[model samples]
Target chain A: DVKVTQSSRYLVKRTGEKVFLECVQDMDHENMFWYRQDPGLGLRLIYFSYDVKMKEKGDIPEGYSVSREKKERFSLILESASTNQTSMYLCASSLTGSIEQFFGPGTRLTVL
Target chain B: SQQGEEDPQALSIQEGENATMNCSYKTSINNLQWYRQNSGRGLVHLILIRSNEREKHSGRLRVTLDTSKKSSSLLITASRAADTASYFCATDRGGYQKVTFGTGTKLQVIP
Candidate 1:
């Protein structure tokens, strides 16, 4: 079975603290994406990487960054945790030229 | 930013009834896909219909795509309580491997 594992299922952080949410996929997919899901807003893409060391900003890339140093691992970074930044973060991986994407369970982050 | 909007933000139905949700997108797409998310879990891809295809089915799930109207719909036949979840429509614009997701329709199947 294809699997995508996240570093944490829940996290709490203080304001101004740095946060890291890690995702690893066993599928060895070429494309990785990071998204923040909020109520009514849906899943807003933060960043995506099609290849190692390459990243593209999505519609809601502000306040967030991503790192894909390896094929199976993709990490999302929050430079400064703010109350507004608290949301469910999801990571997904898909093969190149494929329409289907496998998503991780997700990390619910809380900024206090 | 969301590219698609699903109509009827919430829907309630009996276990044996069918549930249908519609999605309308702004731009032309290479393909459209439907996904289901149970509660706080991540989305699971239900079906994918390319721009050239009109209707497609997988098991009890049927998806229809109309490129002319830039819209799509998903129908779940004889939905059970296990089918209760938020359904979303995602559009792939072809390049960059990026797809935009809609707000999603919250479905409730009461037994």
Candidate 2:
């Protein structure tokens, strides 16, 4: 089975604080993504990486940024956290152009 | 972004009954996938239907796609408590790399 691991299962950060959520995949997939799921809003992509050090912004990438320093790890960074940023964050990895993705346990982040 | 929209936002059914959820997207896609999420946990992939294909099945789950209509449906036969979860349909235009999720359907299978 493909495994994607998120650095934290739950996190609490104060407003204006910086936060980092990490994800690592064992499948060596070329694509990695980060998303924040809000009630009724579903899951909105924050960022995705196609290769090492390569990234692209998704639908809701305004307050977030991502980094892929290596093939297996991708990180999502919140420059300045806000209460509105509280949501369930998910990490996913997949092969290039493949619809089959493997997901990591979500990180429920609360920004106070 | 570009996530499909699921109909009947929520549904409840007795075990052994069938549950169906619909999803509609705005643009053309190379494939559509269904994923199930339990409570606040991670998502598990259920099935994927290519845009060129019309239908597919896995276990008791059946998925049908209407590319011309830009819509799809998922049916769970003889539903069980384990089938209770939020189901989302993701659309990916063939680079297959850019897949977006839909607002999910919350299903509850009452025993």
In terms of DockQ, the best-performing candidate is: 1
Q: Report the lDDT tens digits of candidate 2 across residue range A21-109.
A: 99999988999999889999999988898999999888889989899999999999999999999999999999875778899999999
Per-residue alpha-carbon lDDT of candidate 1 for residues A32-68, written as tens digits (9 for 90 to 100): 9999899999999999999999999998898988898
Docking class of 1: high
TM-score of each: 0.99, 0.97
Off by over 4 Å in 1: none
| lDDT tens digits, residue span B38-100, model 2 | 998999999999888999989999999998889999999999999989999998876638888
Which ten-residue region of model 1 chain B has the weakest summed lDDT? B88-97
How far residue A80's Cα lies from its native spot in candidate 2, in Å, is 1.3
Residue A94 CA displacement from its true place in model 1, Å: 0.3
